[model samples]
Target: MSTKYKFHEPTAIYFISFAVVGWIDVFTRTVYRDLLLESLSYCRKEKGLNLHAWIIMSNHVHLIISSKEGYLLPNIMRDLKKYSSYRILKEIRENTMESRKEWMLYLFSKAGQQNSNNKNFQFWRQDNHPIELDPHLNMFEERIDYLHNNPVEAGLVANAADYLYSSAIDYEGGKGLIDIDVLI
Candidate 1:
């Protein structure tokens, strides 16, 4: 991971993007997607991760996140990604319903082999591409809108609020998979 994508201002909200290696669509499975949701929820409640906005796509996740309990933003994001990677790999390995298990594992294993930082498998990529959000400049709203409309732009849904894995519903005043503080 390069220092350019790191979290520098601890209290500043940042829009970050993290994706699976090779841009694999590993999150097509509900199990893998739900694992990320669960981890995010846990981080919000227990780890003081303040999630302003979030969206989980097929293989990537976007977030408007910040520290609430004085935890460093980078550390919190690192923990979330680390825990989710472990659990998701475990789920993939153990899931009998997974048709692409062997291939996916092979790819992940190969990726891990290419990086000494990983012992066996690697899921999420190292770079977060954190961009500090400036609310005054309308950057914050711009990001939130882009995140909500991602699924729509991808043809996954006709409307942003209809995407089950996104915070668009929360922004629409409807309950979503996880609780969020709407920023847009």
Candidate 2:
């Protein structure tokens, strides 16, 4: 609820991070991660989301995002999160192969009931913790490095570019899961 971390500049690129409620490792599955990637793709194609970079970790995600001339970054983020949450939750509910279905649903239900903003279930934590990139400093490079190296730091992969869920591959001149406007 603090204005310090809110999205104030609509056009300025932002380094944003959001986690699942209780930091549950919901994205451990390929289907869940692909669902998030699909949502990002939809936002980019329909909502004027200028995605600079992104990474989907086991429990959270980080993105370097901005918006086109007539779009608002906050609005795009809200829609992206809301839509992805609904779709992912539905998939989890309907997935007969999901072993953690009941447990995840219970946690989401409990979280939703506790938060007045949600009607039934809560998938993502509310705050995006967006930090506008300062052109005066090296914030862009710094954040992009941090974002790409997350999997490496977590021991998920030996090399950053080897992580398929991140933009590191794109940065390394390889095609990644989602389209990104690589920063120079």
Candidate 3:
């Protein structure tokens, strides 16, 4: 409801970050992460999502993105989160090998019940802090540094480019998991 964090300029590239409810480490498994990757791929191909940079951590995701022609960033993000949540929840529900299945589901269900907007489960938290970047300010390099260095800062990888779930590889002149309109 706050305009402060809302996506205002549809054509402006924005830095957005969203977290899993309760900061749950849902992306620890390959399946859950892959589900999100697939959704991002679909958004890029069909929803006109022009991804500049992105990184998916254990509990949250950060993206620098804009939209092509008629698409809106907020709408694309909404669809991405909604579809990915459904896919992730289904996989969690059906995965007999998931050790944290019951606990994760309980948390998601509780979060859903607490929020009036959700009917069943709330995998992703509602607010996506979107900051429209000002090109004149030259913020892309700083933001991209922060985004790419996340895995290294978290001690997940020795080098930022070593992290497979990020666009840092692309910035380092290598192909990443998904296509991106590299800014650097």
| Best lDDT among the predictions, by candidate number | 3
C-alpha RMSD by candidate, in order: 1.1, 0.8, 0.7
lDDT (Cα, tens digit) per residue for candidate 3, span 47-166:
999999999999999999999999998899999999999999999999999999999999999999999999999999999999988888889998999999999999999999999999
Tens digits of per-residue lDDT for model 2 on 1-184?
4698888877799999999999999999999999999999999999999899999999999999999899998889999999999999999999999999999999999999999999999999988999999977999999999999999899989999999999998989899988888887
Q: What is the alpha-carbon lDDT of model 1 when measured against the actual structure?
A: 0.91
lDDT of each: 0.91, 0.94, 0.95
What would you estimate as the lDDT of candidate 3? 0.95
Query: Residue 8 deviation, candidate 1, in Å?
Result: 1.5
> Which runs in model 2 stand beyond 4 Å of their true positions?
none
Least accurate stretch of 10 residues (summed lDDT) in model 1?
1-10
Error of 3 at 34 (Å): 0.6
If both were scored by TM-score, which would come out higher, candidate 1 or candidate 3?
3
